[model samples]
Target chain A: MNLPKSVSIIEVGPRDGLQNEANFITTEIKKEFIQHLVCAEIKEMEVTSFVSPKWIPQMQDAAELIQSCYSSIRSIVLVPNKKGAERLLATNCKSAAVFVGVSNRFNQKNINKSTRESIVEIRPIIADLKSKGFFVRACISTAFYCHYEGAIATADTLALCQEFADAGVDELSVADTIGMATPAESFSLFSTLKQQLPNIMIAAHFHDTRKMALANIYAALQAGIDRFDTSAGGLGGCPFVPGATGNVATEDVVYMLERMNIKTGVKLDKLVKAIDIIAPHLSRKIDSGYYQLTKKRDISV
Target chain B: MNLPKSVSIIEVGPRDGLQNEANFITTEIKKEFIQHLVCAEIKEMEVTSFVSPKWIPQMQDAAELIQSCYSSIRSIVLVPNKKGAERLLATNCKSAAVFVGVSNRFNQKNINKSTRESIVEIRPIIADLKSKGFFVRACISTAFYCHYEGAIATADTLALCQEFADAGVDELSVADTIGMATPAESFSLFSTLKQQLPNIMIAAHFHDTRKMALANIYAALQAGIDRFDTSAGGLGGCPFVPGATGNVATEDVVYMLERMNIKTGVKLDKLVKAIDIIAPHLSRKIDSGYYQLTKKRDISV
Candidate 1:
């Protein structure tokens, strides 16, 4: 029952949420979505990814999206490799996010590189970003389980995160890539990470594919994690991870945290409104519990 | 992280799930649904209610359905008052469930009785049923929050449960009728109930109106609770609560518990099959997370 007094939510709907979307959303709408999130008091977010348009055509306008976003917000863009990092250096964004899967097979499928190779390539990039006073967050995908490889060994995930921590990253966002982690697994891994890497900020990113996202978040909170990566309207899934659903919805996370007396400094009503901006653009229905409840009933948060 | 090694699940989909449905399912389908749950190793279930046929036509065949169920399973029938209790006695059913809401306004709207009136009337009914060797479960509705009265006082809920415990009910089923209870509220209320009434068997019932059911369930588990009231396919919502959704799905709960290494003695794949029996008959789509994942992907549990 011991929980933090306040938690920080890092919005990921614009990037992680929309990357898997097949339909193209215009840069204007994406900017408008980020503006709505800014009004809702989201201080940090993963706005877009600097990747090849041929691979993920959805993020073709990453540079444009990052340049147009409000400079007051700590907009973080995903950089997959040295090329992506170089692409990010040209943009106005001061924050950059890099990722590597814990599973080699998943890494091979996602970026066509082995885990060791991605780590070796990304280490110097992290140091370079830090040397330039850039905030670098390492997103450790499949930290708990992988779609290609079954349950990930906790030691493997911990070792991978240790490498990133040693590389001078500001934070580590460990993810349940396929959303198959149980609360026990979440608590076990995050508690170890928090113990070993006490100086580094660790955020828990979860996909709601199995509907255990909130429970996993709660476990993470018990392990003293305060930062979360959430999607608006529960949008986004990994195109590489089959049957994966959206990240835990921002509105849903805010609702739970506020109800628990944990401060996220986000307005629930305004947060719910942000979902309306992007819900229609997506091919799937908004599956967020709080959003759907607000639509069906006249209840105020 | 201290949790029970195993948990028991009481299936409420047949009665609590279907009572609110406007469409009537045939008695044969209801029997087959119960049979499927039995095959999934559900040892106990709330099969049906003995309310007036005019009010809930869905349960008009309560007696008929219970009579046809497997005798080895513990079948519980809902009895609202003395009349419902008398009707339950007419059948061969040995278990009866009675309910009272914590909010007086919610009680009046749901059953046309004040909270005090309902408690006063049901006390002797519990005694009478106990004297007759009938196992009784007293369902405490709005244990955390009420739709009409807003957030309910934990003291009010505890006092009402105290009355039932004094009257010798076999177990107490504490419910979050509106699904508005947070994990903190759930942990605070249930932990007190567990500490105060240490000798009694207590079960947690949650509605997924806000999608915090699983998190609330996890909080309850941390508070030392091991029995839960779940619905197959996430079926059932209070017809009286305006925006209330279904209970936490049995399959999802089993998936979490089994993954956490907590035994529920329920086979998830077989439990999902039970949903197929009644899902087509319901007016709304099944909203369970695990159920949706199973249908979308070929991944085996």
Candidate 2:
């Protein structure tokens, strides 16, 4: 199984992670978290989301959080709609992420829009962002399976991916938002996407719900995908999906990649320290296996 | 990637998992745990070890546990040396597991014998067991990396495996006692072993110390390994090796395989219920991801 010499990890803790957290992280702590992550050499990160504060009150300070997190690394923000896009425009950040669910039921439940409607609705926003020189990362939520709709058709997911690519999106992210994918499904889906869209950059975002996230990441790597969306301390889960776990822990992924001789451009011990900074602020225990292992270092090799 | 249509799981939780617990589980509870696992259609299991009670107080009732767990399923017992082997010989159990670390330092520390000496000592024991109609599972601990000696040479591991095969052992088990093997290494090791010993059944026993156990299993499956040693509720760890996590949770592995449409003759829900039976009895928190996921059933897919 051939793999890339180096892999790029896009940390999504601030937005995807903290959003699922019950306790609102103070703006100062969020900024410190980002600063520590940048110290660990994370070049790309989703600093926060631009969704309406009324819906996700925790992200109420999205603009302020972004303003506070001044870093050399690329700062990407989640934009759920044209309003979110407009809010992102006022910020200094030049990168934004938009989403359209492959499962129509999920789209309806998550964004109150159909999958196609989400695509149609986000098209102008994506174009608007691009016109202003913003890099757009179009994410397909429930790319593998949806809690509401069960298994998603590969052809349908590919069609959504193709729509995003045609919209001139800078990147495409296939997300297992519900964390229901197996390694076989991950390998087949990502491999087919890579083969079909050789020119388009594809990224994988997996959840640890079923504990297959890292395994899925490994399979995707074998299928030639080197970019991933991860969260520090293994934070984040969907508020909509039941029993959904957090994203593949950044620490665990980095450990696996570094051990395999695949460069991740991140320091393991430093990353764990970064996790330590935000762990106490969170409402729940950190779920990253690597983080857990580090805490019990007394028993380790 | 090609995978087997079905796989066989050898449950090691009762022996490997319990052996590491600080609290001693009663023989009656162990018997009940074994019965529950058998209800889940688990055909193979390590019921307990026959080591001296003085060294491993937890397994003091190994003979009584095995005698109580009388069933059609293949109940294997761990035998450390000739004395343990003689004790197993007196029991109704017809299968026994013997192990030697490929890393000499680990062998010395774990078994108080060097690798070569341990092999020499077990040669006659294996022959005697075979003559007495006992099936022997020769395990090579630290097949990937050793906690005491660091990296174990692949050649040394393979040489030990070759010796066991020549001794007419019924099966060969390559173990990642410290969970240090990567997918590439797991694939390479198992693929090479399968090629060389086409007629011998090869089983993999992995600890989840680094959280790569399931990923390693996935890679090994691709390499044509059909039999695995798993623990129900992910129970297991090396008492001799510090920082080693439990085996890859049997429920998690079964979930992955069944999702991929590979049959394991085990029911996921039933297995979880079985784990619930032993959860309160465990001294520490259950280490299986699947077991933990089951606790928060409110967020499931």
Candidate 3:
């Protein structure tokens, strides 16, 4: 209960968010989203992903998003391979995020490679990125549970955590790909990862599918992992999964951390205003607890 | 992180819920809710409050809510005074819950009496209920922060907690009256309460207004408090404040606990189904996060 007073928040709405949406956002809207993310003053924003357009056509505008971004922000781009890393490296982006899936079936189902093959493929990509002197953060998906292969063990995800650490990735964030973790699972996994790789900074990425995302973040905090990935207005859902919900709402996470006397270096009212800007463009309700609270707060105030 | 394998959930939706709603629910529907709660196999349910109908017209049916029960259920009724306690004692209710706000200002605002006067009132009420052979649980409201007077130090709520324990009450449920508590504040209060009165069971009542209710519950659990007060579909908005949300959602609590491998003695699916019965009666959207998750779940499955 007695810990350092404040923690940092890593905002990932622009990148992790747009990648999961089915509709391809216009280059202008994607650019605006990034601008709004910057306006929120969230220091570590993951701007875009350089994955195959064929796989996730929604993010085909990655280059334009990066090209259009303002220079005052510190952003990280998700790059799938050396080609994507090479593409990202061409830009002024100083950091790139690499991904690996814990479940073999999920890796094959999602990214068109076996788990082992993906790790092998990622090593060179990470090495090349590191060699380029770009800050690297590795992401491991399905760390909690797999859609194709149910409940994953803590040891499985910890092994990949070791692999990422071995890859010399500066930071690692575990993604609850299918939103299947309990608070206990989240705490146990993060504690194990921290124990094994203390030098590697850890971030949490959670889907709000079962409404356990924020709770999972809370659990991770207990395990001493403070950084997190959240989407503005809860923008994206996995189209492949019929009923998956959006990512953890950035506003909600900030609201929680701020009230807990934890600092995330973001202004809440401005974040709500930014979410309001993005709400009209989305087809669904803003999947955020904060959006609702803020909306109510606005009317009441 | 590695503690008890499971935490128990106590649902207080019907009593805490119906008492706060603006609409008048008939005795028949109240009976249906009781039947539903029993069908859900919820181990503990706060069915109604034994307060003066003149002051709280919404809770006029406290005696009927327990008397007209169509199901075999162990019910607890909130008692505000000896008269109300005498009335509820006539019924088969197992426990009588007495309440007093910890803050002098909140106690005055909520019960129209100072802390000492409220305790003086609850003493006779608790003694009478105990004499009648009814189990008793005491609730201390505004234990964290008050809307009128923010910054309630842990010492004040702790002093109230000890008073409840000394009163020979069976359990104590602390409430964040205006949804103003952070996890740190909740942790500090609950840990101190457990340290002082380990035998007096502790439960939590939280509002999701600030989006910390679930995490606040998590913090309380880490502080070794298990039981909680929750409203199905997050039904109650504070009547005094009008449109202000109150009481954590029962469904969200079940979702968090079940995922954590906690045994709350409540059926998640049945609790989900109970939402339907309550949602239509609601004039506004239910604030429960699990409501959206469950709706998606039913459609997907």
Q: Could you list the CA RMSD of all candidates, in the order they appear? A: 1.1, 1.5, 2.9
Angstrom error of the Cα, residue A101, model 1: value is 0.2
Interface RMSD of each: 1.5, 2.2, 3.3
Best by lDDT: 1
Q: Give the Å error, residue A239, model 3.
A: 2.8
Please give the range of 10 consecutive residues that has the lowest summed lDDT in model 3 chain A: A292-301
DockQ of each: 0.71, 0.65, 0.40
True-vs-predicted CA distance for residue B257, candidate 2, Å: 0.7
lDDT of 2: 0.87
Model 3's DockQ? 0.40
Tens-digit per-residue lDDT, A1-301, candidate 2:
7899999999998888899777788988888888889989999999899998877989998988888445598899999998998888888899999988999999998889888888888999989999999988998899999988888999999988988999999899899988889999999999999998898889999988777887899899989999999999888888888777788889888888998899999987788888888989887898566788778856452
TM-scores of the first chain across all predictions?
A: 0.98, 0.97, 0.94
Poorest stretch of ten by lDDT in candidate 2 chain B: B292-301
Candidate 1 structure, TM-score to reference: 0.99
Candidate 1 regions with alpha-carbon error over 4 angstroms: none
Residue A243 error for model 2, in Å?
Answer: 1.4
TM-score of chain B of each: 0.98, 0.97, 0.93
Better of 1 and 2 by DockQ: 1
